[model samples]
Structures are given as structure tokens and as C-alpha cells.
Target chain A: MTDQTTNWPDHLTGDAQPLEVGILLYEGHTALDLVGPYTTFALAGMKVHLVAETLDPVVSDDGGMTIAPTTTFDDCPERLDILFVPGGGMVYKPMLDPATIAWLADRGATASYITAVCNGPLVLAAAGLLDGYRVATHWASRDQLARLGVEVSTERVCIDRNRFSGGGVTAGIDFGLTVVAHTLGEKAARFAQLVMEYDPEPPFNAGSPESAGPEIVALRTRFMAEPDTALRNAVSHVLEQRAATSSHPVSDENADPAAGIVND
Target chain B: MTDQTTNWPDHLTGDAQPLEVGILLYEGHTALDLVGPYTTFALAGMKVHLVAETLDPVVSDDGGMTIAPTTTFDDCPERLDILFVPGGGMVYKPMLDPATIAWLADRGATASYITAVCNGPLVLAAAGLLDGYRVATHWASRDQLARLGVEVSTERVCIDRNRFSGGGVTAGIDFGLTVVAHTLGEKAARFAQLVMEYDPEPPFNAGSPESAGPEIVALRTRFMAEPDTALRNAVSHVLEQRAATSSHPVSDENADPAAGIVND
Candidate 1:
């Protein structure tokens, strides 16, 4: 058994083979979106790999903080127990990257649970994995996400079948706990929750657009205007390309990476 | 102004100077503890420098994730607006490192605010910076912090003069928002709050000892018992060393780094 699973109960350890989680890392990805869920999974004694396109460091949305990716696309596991994507101010880069979208579509097909937090659902949407699923995204991106032809939920932790997603940046914690509970039982989730001291106390009542009032929401909207527009444009372009190339849809049986690449 | 602050109002830019924040990075530190506050600070238009002993990538408590430090101790700004630390499962390493303590002591003496989240205050207490100050820490480490002669508050975000601290791993978000609210105005904090969607909905009520009840708390306590014991021993040793070396105390007036190092 790995050192990470030594203290956990037998049930949690899965007979000494811990749960393998792959969290996608990309430039401009929000740190909290990744770290929130990563901490919970780590505490749950799961093996997590920060998967990126390259082995080089991945710079987050917040310019200065850079995270070294544990595994690259060429080396990540074929099937992750849980595949997660984190949202960012500029998720369009990854949403439009063919390599990232292909990797997600490939691994996500067999993953036990396909998940995302914040605007991360947008990335999954870009990969066509969350096409008909009800996914949650950052409040600012809900409209843009809806443009991608997916059902958008306003809930914090929206679990629609196997596609579990969360709202906004800080929502990843709530989303992580919910996923843990679903996969590892409520006891384990509650245990991880206490470990993280997941009780939140927001200093202000400006979390949502309704609560933040008009002025603050407008300010944030203005700040997000460019990125929101970029995401919309990227969604439009990806949809057009998907339409152009997918005139003859391939059967799901023959759509695996081992067979042939089928985006839709 | 830098790209990070372009969206912010003129008042926050500080005449084109952003808030210079130095967050100490050490091995075994919790990823969420650092990332939570980092997201907030980044959104607040602050210049955050992840300072470490060296420029090497610092591995977090979660073994797989590694973050590259932005600056080294020698290269860090002499005076920072905020000198912060984040707690971890093995903070005893940094707590006992003389260079870390000395560096914190030197920079902390002049920083406008010396802040920490979770057991991070324990590091400050070890550096002789929190002596006689009221602080907050992870619920599990409150007693250990108090043993170092600092008053411990059970509040999530505890502010005592320039020493601001938070409770546990997830409290860093609250701590960051509180720090931003204190340094900047409520407007900036609220703005950042809305931007990040600070609204939290914990899927589980088991966040604190009280809310988690005795059973889950016991599980967490048992898990933390070993590290808790180590922290106690480290605190005892640091206190003894402080007593032994400070028999003849030099005045703080003459204790600047330019003259000689005076810890305590």
C-alpha cells in the first residue's frame, strides 16, 4: 500500500489499491478550483495525478502561482476513477485545444465518474462529454455554458447521473464532498469534511448576483466581459467544427480512442 | 499597472503599486491553505510572491502536487504589506527551521500585517512574532498555539492588531477575504467576493468539532494525534530555546537585521 492509504480503513483503501483521480491542469486554470477538490481527494486517501499537456509547470490564472504537472497527456492513466477539470478566467484556451479535448473524451468515456467544478463543465462541454448532461458552472458562465447545448443547473453541487459538477470557484469543496460521498459513502465524506473544516463563513453577502446587488454584479460582469465573450466565441467555433466534421455520426461502440476519434 | 490590476479601480492600484504579499512556502504545507487565500489576494489585485528557502518547487502536503516558488528568501521584498503562512500536516519542519523562523522574524517585524491560516499561526508563534498577540489556528492546534504564550481565538477569522489568523484548512478563504477587507475597503473585498462567487454551501454539516459531533471528531483527532504530539514537543523546545537565549534581552530598537538578529 502507498503511504497515503496506510491509515485508512480497508473499505477506503479498496484492498490497498487507492482510488485513482486525474485532475486536468492547464494554463490560466483557477488554483482554488483545482486545490479545493484536490485537498478533499488527497484527504480521502485517493491517488491524484495533476494531468497536463506537458511535464512542464502549469501556470494558473493568477499569474505568479505555477503548479508542476505530475503526469502529461501521453502518460496519464487510460481510465481514471474520477476525471476532474477546473475552471478559470481563460478556459477557452483548453476548451479549444484538440489534445486536451481528445484526452478528456478518451479517458472520460471509461471513468467511473466524470466531474468538473466552476466553469470546468465548460471544458467537459467542449470535449462533448457533457453534451446532454445537467452540469453546474460558475454563475458568470452559466449563460455561455447554456450556449454549448447543455442543461445548466444553478445548484452548488449538481449531480446529474455520472456527470457531477459544481458552481464557481469556491464551490469545488462542496462538489468534492458530494462526489466522495457518492463514491466512498457518507462516512468518508463527512470525515474528509471535518478534516478540511469545510464549514464556510463568508464575510459578505455578495456571493451571487442577486445577493451582490446590481453595482457589484455589474462590476464583476464588466471584468468578466472579455473572457465571457471569448468563451462564447470559442463555443461557437467548436460547435461549428463539430457540425462540419460530424456529418456522419459514428456509433458509440466504435468511438473509443482505440477505434477512431469521434468528437460528437 | 500590471495586467493583474487593470480591472481594479484606481484606489486599489496604490498609484500603480499593488499590495506586495509574501506567502511563505515550505514542504508539507496544505495546498488549499495556500490556494484559498491566493485566489482572494490575486483577485484583490495584489502582487503575491510565493517565497521559499530556494526557487525549487515546493511539494505540498498532498504528495503529488508541487508548486514552483516565485521568489527565494534572499530575493523576497525586504518589507511586505502582508507576510503570510499556511499550515500543514507536517508544519513542524518549517516551524523548527531556523532560517524560516529567522526570515519570518526579520520580515514580520515590518510587514503591515503578519497573517496565517490554520496552524500557520504556530509558525509565527515559533518565530517569536505572535508573543502576547491573540491568534487563531486550526481547532486541533489551538491548545498547542496557546502553549506558546499567545491568546487563541475560536473565531474563524481572528484579528488582533496586525496579526490576523484563521481556523483550519478551509478557513483560509475567510481569512483572505477578511484580510482584504481590512487592508482594502469593504468594496474591494465584496467585489472580489462576488468575482470568486464566495457563497459556500457545504454539502455536509460536519465541519467543526461541534458540528461534526464526537465520533467524526474522534476519527480526525486520532488521525492528527501523532502530528499534534510533534507540534507540542516542538513548541516546548522552541519556548525553552527562547528562554535560554533571551536571558539578557537586547532592545527591539537595536534588533533590526542590519545590527543583529534578536528573536523573541
Candidate 2:
């Protein structure tokens, strides 16, 4: 992978080529996952393109918001400084889509940085991008990621080699800043932070399951039951694909065993 | 002035009316200001409507993204659980627009909660909504907000009566979580926080002037020179209008005499 540091000169007082960032947009992806990093990178003067299969507006998981993609998969820039994927309820659909997976595989091969937030890393894992790389993903999907043979980091933002992954949705902002710091320098990242006022103060100390306590965690788990089923099914499909491709037959050790039962 | 707590029954285990939130969308508004809270509130099950003057796509200040409005100002629901406004480079344009100000005045008068992020409070103040109310706004716009006779709070999120204001762009998420806690209760807000992974970890601690040190602050100040002039002109225009309508002339003491001059 090309070192982006060479592209951004030390004395970037005025002259510097705009960083080309391609953010994957798909149906039912969480809006915040895309917008958080989009806002951060845009503030840092990066050229961000919301890329999808088509130019149509992509409806978010909430079904209340629609974001139009700036470029189609076929039209996206050949070389991108950053290639990012976001995760949401319908993430399983994209994980199973051959076209989307192929796009990721092709882009991941040459992009200076490969990144994902939330369940987005699952899509990358399904695409075989995280076959051996350690990554971070939404806490709810850590077990699923480990099942895919990817080492899951507990950090909010994890950077392993050229791959940057963030935990869940809002961590995209943190991931974006880290990327900026690496590519554009800490000063540039801090300038973007100051512009966006990225100092966060949560009114409650319940952003994580550990802090949210048992009752709230149980409630959240209950609320996510439907999505969890979809995710499990998707995981099974990926595992079956891996088994079919390899000479070795499907073994219990290769699967979660508990969640290996394919629905349908 | 109606209490929203009454609308949400105490035993909201399964049954609860969706919170109707209308986020004002305007040309040249900062995308993060609206997106941060929109993501938080949407995750919390709020029916967030991107309300704007038209159904056309509203381009953000950076011109890198465009957000299509879900509903026009005239077509928005008459009653809303929360009414929000975001701020950016052309924030002054909306602050001076009669139609936008009229819509804000009308909706703000009856909305359960009135909110703004960044310099958005300047618009609220322009509509006379923040008159005699303590509020929070972007640090760069503090002097501009105080010039409007609104008491500026140094807190990241300030709630005065029914008016909830947030400091700068990223403060919207904190403001949204606070609103969720107040309306749907703490558990619901915490659930939303967990889902979004709202635990923020910025790589740099230079989010505010006090934190960024004087050198970065000076750089930011220099960067904001043009927008500052536009804001001052807008403030002067609002002050002139106030004087023309009231028997009392525009008092030098009421203005931030330092920035009361309209350059053009």
C-alpha cells in the first residue's frame, strides 16, 4: 500500500492534493456511521464521495433518512486515499451481495487505507479482507467477527497496519481523526476537531454495555434480537462459502457450533 | 409549553408514541450540527424530519454534501416534540430571512422543546426566542450571540426553560441525548447511547480554544475572518430591525460595540 504521508508534504501550508475518500453507501446502513467520518474528513478538506451500486438515494436503517450517493461503484475513483464501509440493520444484505463484496475486494487491494465502523467490519470480513487482520467492530458483533477468524480489538478505534476500524457507529469520528492524523498530520486533525468541536460529553455514563448495566443491556439485547438473527444467518452463509472453497470439509471447530445452524 | 413527559407514559416497555423531531435544514448549514443529533435522536426512536424551506437538496457549507429535506416548512407538522436548528457559514443568511425566522417563531412558540447547535442560537435569538434566555453557542460566535442580548452559557449544553442550546457542532449529540433523557427517560437515552457507541475518544484534546492553546486558536481565528464579518453584518441588521420596531433606539451598550459595524 502507498504511504499517504508522501502525498501530503510536511509543509502543507497551502499546496496539497485533496485526499480522495470513498465511503460505501448501501440500503439500511446506519446514517451516523457514514456522516460522522464524512463530517470529520470533509472538515479536514478531504474530498469525500458517497459511493453505492447506483446513483439512487440510499435509505438508512431507520427508514427515516435518505442519502444520495455521489458516485456509483462503476464510477468511483480508481485510486482512493481512504475506502470506508458503515454498518447497520440491513448490513447482512450487503454482506451477501456478490457485487458489493467484489467491489470491496477490488478496492481493498489498492486503497491506501481500508476502514469500517460498527458491523461494517463484518462486510469486510465476508469479503475476505479481514481473513487474518485484527480489527475492531461493534461490541454486539465481536463474537461474530471472532467466528470469522478475525481478531477483534476492544478499542473504540483500532489501527492495525493500513486497516483502520472503529467500534460501532459514533466511533467513526474517532477513526476519522486517527486517519487524518496519520495522513494529514496531528495539526490538521486537531484543526478539524476544533472546527467540528469534537469534544464529547455524554450526559450519562452508559455508552457501553459495561457502563449501561445489566438491565439496560438486556433491554438493548432484546431490542436487537431480530437484527441479531439476520447477522447470525449472514455469518453462517459466509462460513459455508469458506468451507465450500477450502478442500477441508466443514468442521464444528470452524463454526460457532451454537449459531452454525443455517436458517432456511 | 406542554410537558412531553405526559405524552410518554411511565410504563413505556412496548407502547410509546414516536418522538416528533423537526430539524431545520438550510443552505450552507454545517452538516455535523444537524447529523450528530439526527443520528442520536433517530437511534433513540425519534421521528426526525429534516425540515427546510423546500424539498430540494440543501447543500452544506463545505459544498461536499447535500441533504434532501423530508418536509417543507409549510408542510411540517404543526406540533413537534422538538424543534432544532443547525449553524454554519451561511447561518446569518437564515437568521435574517423573514420566512425562516417566521417559521421558527411559530414552531418554537409551541414546540415542546426548542433547540439549536453552534451559532444556530443566533437564529433563535433573531426570532426573539432567546431574548432574556441563557443559551450556549459556538465559541467563535460567543461574542456575536452575546451581542444579541442572549446570556451565553459556557457549558457544552445549556437548557434554559424549554430552550436547549448546544455549543458548536459536535455538541448536538450531547444535546440530543439530554433531550432523550428528559422526554423518554434515562434508560431509553442510555440504550441509544449503547447502540450508537457514543463513548467519544478524540485523538487530540484541542477541541476548544481553551484546550487548543493560543496558536491554534489564532490560526482558527484567521481562518474564520470572512465568516466573522458576515456574522457581524447579520447582527447589525438584526439590531437595526429591532430598533426600528421598538420605541427605544439601538443602544451601544446592548451591542458588542466591537462587532456592531456592517462592513458593506
Candidate 3:
């Protein structure tokens, strides 16, 4: 029963109830994308649920490892404080699955905060949840996300109103900390940060395209091509279906105001 | 079949056989500690296996999520290119388990490289693997690790010959990348970095005790006190058992030479 949150200072927790976080899990969802944020939320005394369609295990996109879901979509709490999604190779699979998209749409509508990392925003966009919010996603998927009618930012962590998005895989940690700061206060996030030892020293400076130089960037571009194309094609299909159902939604007036977006 | 490794430039992979990496998993291993490095190894075309005592789902220390192991201690390959362990609250459980220690001792003898992150080094040392090697662990457990007759370092990533270790939780990503650089090549590790978008921008500058400031450091110290004491007691018990079985092994003559250690 003793945990990092066991003797959480009353001043840090204040009157805040433990945030209920529902992280969507599906076939091929990347493990780190979910885990980085999950750790931050869990350590900060948030209730995180790995929400999947069934009780069956969800295999990661990386292959080999599988994570069991804590709750099924049907069994998840009707209202969540945070609705999160993680990106991966087959994110398109979930984007096209009506059941998954419907669940995302339903939960995202009332969730206090909508969050995602990497290509996760694409799934949110597919559900029409990110229509007017500027979000961040993996650099490789930014273009594709823009094609979904979602304004994409290049920052590692982007916050627009209640939408919190992170760029690529590791950015989930930063994104999660930012969310904790917003929800619980900077002190609580700092406590989680210390617990996680978030100080990073990447062996190489190739995390972003601009810094990775030409050769490495070209190689990663080639490597990401197929999956990128698949995601693009899936987004086009979603757009076409949306077009057929309803034309010209998410008006300029509905766009999240410029003041709400935090580029940092 | 097309993965990031598809068409991997011949020069990057060269004549290297895919690395066989076995990451230890137990009931309460931290998810990020495993996933961070697992992502790097998996992306670098390494055959990373989640090894456990049995094939059942292993719950994480943070709670909620459960990861299914790919191989059991009894079934894992006899020799591994890399043997890895992840840190968590209950790392002591594995450190005290004879079957797990025996298996690690068996594998560590011949693994091309032995690696750990966070308090994972304690588990490795408990198995009599890190004896005399300068290793790194979570800052909170550095004192505990040193008690196991292992030389400890404060660096985020420490490399002593074939022993590669890392600091707490998030440091696993950096540790894994370093291992990839040593095994495959720097270019290969760089490619994985780009694939992961490893750039980290912490919302707050409070990851290390040095930067976390005194107040946050105090909070984390208090939060970690119980677990730290438990690990210290476990390490003492392990040393007692080791002393009772074999008196004063790993002598000065057996110490890894100065040239083998990479402080950075």
C-alpha cells in the first residue's frame, strides 16, 4: 500500500481529486508513448486506466512485448478527467475502427483534458476531437496530421486549451509533466519529475530532423515512408467520409483562440 | 515486414547479427525503466526479449499496466548479446529470488554486455555480476548499489567494459542508445534516436537532485526513503548470504582495469 503517493503532502494535492486518466490501447500502439505519460500521471497520484476494447492483451508496434489492459472500453468510467492516446505504426487501424473511434469521440467529448503523443493526435483528429486545436505529434506525422484539418505545431509539447499533445515518442514525458503542472501545479509535477529523474542525455543529437543532419534525416525519412503513406491514406479516407457526412465543419470562430496555445 | 529496419543502410548494420537482448521483468518492475531501453534496442534491429521466470503477465511497480514476458528464465537463450534489468520499488523481490539470481548469474557470465537502469544494478550485483565494475544506478540507490561491492558512478550512463548501466527511470533510453552505439555502431544508435525523436524538453528543470532544488529534493528523498531503506536491507541480506557462501570474492586482481571504464 506504500507508494510514492503514500504520504503525498496535502499542500501538493490540495483539494484536487485524483485525476481519472483513460489511455486508449489497441493493436500495435507504441509502448513508450503510453508508458512515459502513464508513469508521470501515476506517480503524481492520478488514476490511469489502460483502456482497450477487450480484456485481451494489446501487443506493441515494436513487436515482442504485450501490455494487458486494465479496463475495457465498455467498462471504463463514463467520464474521465483525462482521455489519452498513444501513437504507433498501426494507429491507422484504430482510426478506421468505428468502435474505437466512437469510444474516443464519446469520452473525449466530456474529458476535462484531451491528450496524445506521437501519431496519437491523428486518432483524436479522426474522432473530430482535435478539429480546432493546435497540437503536436511525431515530426514524421506532422504533415499528415495537418491534412486531417488539425493545426500542427513543431514544438515538443503543445498545449491548446484543454488539448495536450507531445511530439514523437519521448516527448510524452515532457507532455505528461506539463499536464501535471496544469492540473496539479508545478510543485506536484516537479515531484514527479524528480521521481522519474527526467534529466536526459541522448547519446546522439539526432532526435529532430533539423538537428539530425541530412544523411540521418534522409535515412529516417525513407524508413518512415511506408507507414507515413499508410497514415496519409487513412486520413484521406477519414476526410472523405467526413465530407460525405458533413461539409465544412470546425469554423474559424470555433478554432481555439491564439491566446490559449502555448508554443513552448 | 517493412519496419524501420527495412533497407537499413548496409553500412549501419554491417555484418552484425541482430543483437539478442534479454530484459528482465518481474511482478513490480517500472514500466518506463523497461520500455525506454526496450524501444531503443528494438528499433536498433536487436532481438529484444522480455525475459521472466514464467510466461504470465508481469504487473509494473507503478500499478495498472501489465506486460507479458516473451521468454522464461528456463527458456531464454543460454547466451545473450545483452542482458538487461530494469529498476523499480520491488526490484528487491527479484534480487532475493534464487531462481532469478541464478538465471542472471548464468546469463551474465557470457552476455556480450551486461546492462541495467535505476536500481536494476542492485539486482545485477545481487546475482554477483557487477562485482568490481563501475556502474550507475538511480541516484537514490547509488549508496545501496555500492554496498554490493560494486563501484558506483553518478553519470547518467556509465560504461565499464561490457558492463553498461544507467541512472533512474528515464535514463534507460540513454543507456540503451549507448549500448546500441557500442554494439551496432553510433550511426545505428543515431538512427534509432531519430526514429524515436529522442529530444527531451522537460517542462521543469528538476530531474536531478542537483537541479530539483532543495525543497523538491526533500520531498523526493522522503518519498523514496521507505523503498531506499528496503533496498538497503535487501542488499545487506544479499551480501550476508554471499559472504556466508563464498568469503571475499572479486578481489583487487579481478577489478576491471582503469582503461576499461568510460566515465561519461
lDDT of 1 by residue, A104-207 (tens): 99999999899999889888988889877887888877766776667778888898888999899998999999888777667778899988888898998988
Q: Which tens-of-lDDT digit does each residue in B1-264 have in candidate 2?
A: 334455443323436567789998998898888888898787667789999888988888878777789999999999998999998889988998999999999998889889999999999999998877888888888888878877788789998888898988989889889988887777778888988888888889988887888877776777777888999999989999999999986553433443432211
- Candidate 2 or 3, higher lDDT? 3
> What would the per-residue lDDT of candidate 1 be over residues B216-264, giving only the tens digit for each residue?
8887777678877888778777767776788854232212212211111
For all candidates in order, the CA lDDT equals 0.83, 0.83, 0.84
lDDT of 3 by residue, B1-264 (tens): 112333345533444456688999998899999999999988877888899989989999867879999999989999898899999988989999999999999999888889999999989988989877899988878767766767778899998888999999999999999988877778778888988899889989999888989999898777667777778678778867876787664332113223233345
Measured by DockQ, the strongest candidate is 3
DockQ of each: 0.63, 0.66, 0.67
For each predicted model, how many residue pairs clash, with residues at least 3 apart or on different chains? Answer: 0, 0, 0
Which residue runs of candidate 3 sit more than 4 Å off their true CA positions? A1-16, A247-264, B1-16, B248-264
Q: Which model is ahead, 2 or 3, in terms of TM-score? A: 2
> What's the CA error at residue A23 for candidate 2, in Å?
0.4
Highest-scoring model, lDDT: 3
User: Can you rank all candidates by DockQ, best first?
Assistant: 3, 2, 1
Clashing residue pairs for model 1: none
